[model samples]
Target: MKTLIDYLNAIPVEARDSFAARCGTSFDYLRQVGYGNRACTERLAINLERESGRELVCELLCPDADWAFIRAAPPPGRRRGRARNRTT
Candidate 1:
């Protein structure tokens, strides 16, 4: 499967900054995630997936989660109870 680093490296250098900004994160943070130095948060993964036009899929970004099931489920009206925390 293609990784975030692979996508990052594949894109043009000049576009990196703007892409990162559009993903609501710094290029440095993306670099860290790409290099496996930092964990990619679910929100950031979703943002990257959307901003990258699905180039950086959340399945690859957050491997631990069951993305297929999540996608199959209906959208929640309001989240209940404490948020499920993930360990980076």
Candidate 2:
């Protein structure tokens, strides 16, 4: 299993800031979590999984959580950007 540090290290240095922003945190915080200097919260773990396109899965981030059910279910359709308002 790849560790968070492995995932973080795999990212190019130039993209780290943008990637961290997409995960709703600063690269410094992510670095801390990766190095085991800080705890990775459940919310952050989920966000990382979603943002990493499941490359960093919740199962890897939060091993204690029962994620089998999630894997058993089909993935939901993804929507990008803001929803358009429809005029009736």
Candidate 3:
């Protein structure tokens, strides 16, 4: 099976730097995460997804979490609650 690092490394060299920049990370840092030397955080996963259009969060980061619930959750620093009442 191809590891995440393998997949990442397979991308064209010319595009690698752009991917890293778009993810707001360096290739070295991403390589470390792919190698399991560093933990994959949700924020980073979201960035990667946004930049690459690949949802690696479940496969890489929160594999044990309920992804369905995660998908239902609001964005960062936000919550699901009732709206305010209108003044009469």
> Quick one: best lDDT, which candidate?
1
* TM-score for each candidate, following the candidate numbering: 0.77, 0.69, 0.65
- Local distance difference test values of all predictions, in order: 0.87, 0.85, 0.73
lDDT of 3 at 82: 77
> What is the per-residue lDDT of model 2 for residues 1-88, given as tens digits with 9 covering 90 to 100?
5688898999999999999999899999998988879888878889999888888888778777777976676557745567789999
Instruction: Choose 1 or 3, whichever is better by lDDT.
Output: 1
Which candidate tops TM-score?
A: 1
Of the two candidates 2 and 3, the one with more favorable TM-score, higher being better, is 2
| Pairwise TM-score winner, candidates 1 and 3 | 1
Give per-residue CA lDDT, model 1, range 1-88, as digits (tens). Answer: 5688888888898999999999898998999999999998888989999998887799989888788988877677746567788999
Which segments of candidate 3 are over 4 A away from where they belong?
A: 1-3, 64-66, 74-88
List the candidate numbers ranked by TM-score, top first. Answer: 1, 2, 3
Worst ten-residue run, lDDT, model 1? 73-82
Clash-forming residue pairs, model 1: none
